[model samples]
Target: MLKNVVAVVLEEVHPFELGVACEIFGLDRSDDGLPVYDFALASARPGPLRTHAGFSVDVPYGAERIAEADLVIAAATGIQDGFPAPLIEALRAAVERGARVLSICSGTFLLGAAGLLDGRRCTTHWRHSERLAARFPLTTVEPDVLYVDEDPVITAAGTAAGIDACLHLVRKVQGPEVARGIARRMVVAPHRDGGQAQFVARPLPAEDGDSLGGLLEWLRHHLDQELTVDQLAARAHMSPRTFARRFQQETGTTPHRWLTGQRVLLAQRLLEGTGEPVDAVAARCGFGNAATLRHHFGRWLGTTPQAYRRAFGGVGQPAGR
Candidate 1:
């Protein structure tokens, strides 16, 4: 049923996101017995346009192609000084015709500009999550997730998260089996639990040239232990002050915030995948108690731990994923 896909490329469109659309639908994988999707890139004007990375591309298709598309994708691009009226109309027309729509990264801004996400659940790159929320208060914003699949409209985080949204579309259109096969071929994880917090600005590699990557692996393995800033700094052989400053610079967040996010992520997995008591789950995730977990969950996710589990846990079906 999903035969044709139209991707609208705007000025300063990110090449990586455009490439993601091409890789997922533009390639002919019929030899592998995959359904071939008719994929085309369109622009408001059919001529060479500049990209975000300082290059120009010539797209042959124009806005008219979108009218015939079964699915439409908006690739990430730099924001214009103001929204382009014609482009917004084209997007609105496609969505009005019942075409499934998707947006990658800042592309969500375009959807907002077109008034498509007025009452929809959507996400953009976490860095822009606040902006999206401030600009469109009526739209429910879930910044921590990799993508939000709200049936007809799907939105994803930055760059690589676009792949997750595309594969999600494939899984919905085809099946999980087909999606898993493609993921394996792509050498990416079959699935990522939690959300974009799992990939958000991570702490930089240790300056000691020891590669904190291994240290992080160890920390994950020992999350149940009480972790202090001093202990974490010691692991990297730096003074607590220096470590704290560097951690914020590298991860774009403080050590305390990152730790809290990790613990919450762990608690979510436990709550969903296991029958562990909330108290035990909290302890394992460094919350030390169910009340703590519940408090943080309410603060960050706008729900209690029990409610979150019931909504997204075993035998519990979330209204949307």
Candidate 2:
């Protein structure tokens, strides 16, 4: 149903954020059996737009194009003094006509300017979250999460989080198979929960020895093993408290939460790509049983394992916040 998409470009747009919109929506992927969107870029005054990266993009469409879109994207432009009035009106009108709008990074500020974020929960990049909240007091700003899908309007944290948000909308409307196919072609993770914290790693001193990269990889391969904080601490040659602190510093999340996320990700791959039974997949991912898998899967993906399997077979909806 989300066939048309328009990414609204403003002065000083971040090319990477704009590219995220283009990569997910503009590119033709019909050869891969994925849907091809009627995607284009629109601006207040269509022409060569300067990017914050010191480059220029020749956007060929104007604000009028937003009216035809089922979804509108506000790519990152940081905090700007003012927005184009006509473009803001178009964004409001598009959403009022039942279309959804997504803002990546500081682009959420544009949505705030248009009054779209009012009375809704939203987020931007953590670096800009405080400013967004202070500037838009009417909206509840969640600073740490990757995104907030208040639908009709979704706000994502910076960078890779945009991919997660867009793919979620794809799975929600076009089914998991389409989302999976597109993600495969993109060579990216197909699903990341919106509630996952934004990663802000702080590496230990070089003398503290190579971070936990190797240990993290080991855990991923041996996810089925019932490991505990104390056991992991022993493996890392540190006290339980020291391990927990270092894990939080390096991963931006507690060890338990990071392990759970990895297991859920593994479960998603098994459910969609393999014919393994629910219990088998659960055990392989450390959930231990179908009920536990269902519980975690439902909490993480907002869909049951059976529903996910069926969705990959061409039905069901998946989303989370």
Candidate 3:
């Protein structure tokens, strides 16, 4: 049902995001037995629009073009400037008529300006997450996730997350087979759950004379061992209850959840970098058995270990090869 699509291009549109929309919805994939969208670009007043990369693209359709679209994309653009009033109203009207509207990265600001994000949960790139939250106080922002899908108004983070969001929409509407075909053609992942965390750059957990920090590094190196809160509490020289509270305050997550996240992250690396069997990887990560590892990996990543290896780790290659 997601056939007609239009990208609303504003001045200083980010080319990578505009390209993301064009790549997923604009390209013809009918030869691969995939549905081809009738895609075009539109602006508030149809004319030449400059890109952030110091180039120009002539947009031929006006805001009225949005009336015929089943999906409208507010591609990433300059967020500091005011949006055209007519364009904002067109976006609202499209949403009112049951058409889905999506924004990529800083394009979320446009949705915030249009009042489309006032009551919904949304997200943008982590770099802009705080600004988006500060400017749009009504919406709850989940800064770490790749995308937030609140029906009819999805918002994606960076450019990669934008592709994930589009493929998600495709899979939701047209089925997984079609989504996989499109991804194969693009040579990207067939799917990445919208709830997956963005690969945010974080400082290493250094043990610079910090008690909890030292414990974190130790846990990383000893992931093969079964660690409980009581043992960890004793190691830190605190009662279990006090340790739980302090750990939560320090990491923003429960001890168990943090350990699981860490284990899953290690599993991801092993799956990507080595040809170890699932059972071996499970033992190495202290998952006890392959079944337990599969259960937790699927719960955390929305995919099986074998499937992840197929996508990331070279199939059948030896370790360190």
The per-residue C-alpha lDDT of model 1 at residue 94 equals 81
lDDT of 1 by residue, 1-321 (tens): 588998888999999999888988888877777778899888887888889999998888988888889888999998655666777888888888888889999999988888889998999988888999999888998987789877688898998888988887886676555566677767885444324452434445757774546666787777788999999999889999988876765655677776777787688777766777788898999889988888989876668887766655666434223
Q: Write the per-residue lDDT of candidate 3 for residues 1-321, one digit (tens) a residue.
A: 799999999999999999999999888888888888899999998889899999998999999999999999988998876889988999999999999999999999999999999999999998899999999999999998889888899999988899999988887677666787899999998677576667522334436644488888899999999999999999988999989977766765678988888788788778876888888899999898889999998887678888777666644754432
CA RMSD of each candidate after superposition: 6.4, 3.5, 8.5
Error at 162, model 3, angstroms: 0.6
Q: What TM-score fits each model?
A: 0.64, 0.89, 0.67
Which candidate number has the best TM-score?
A: 2
Which stretches of candidate 1 lie above 4 Å from their native place? 193-321
Ranking by lDDT: 2, 3, 1
Q: How accurate is candidate 3 locally (lDDT)?
A: 0.86
Question: In model 2, how large is the Cα lDDT of residue 131?
Answer: 83
When 1 and 3 are scored with lDDT, the better candidate is: 3
Candidate 2: where is the Cα deviation over 4 Å? 203-209, 314-321
- Candidates 1 and 2, the one with greater lDDT: 2
Residue clash pairs of candidate 2: none
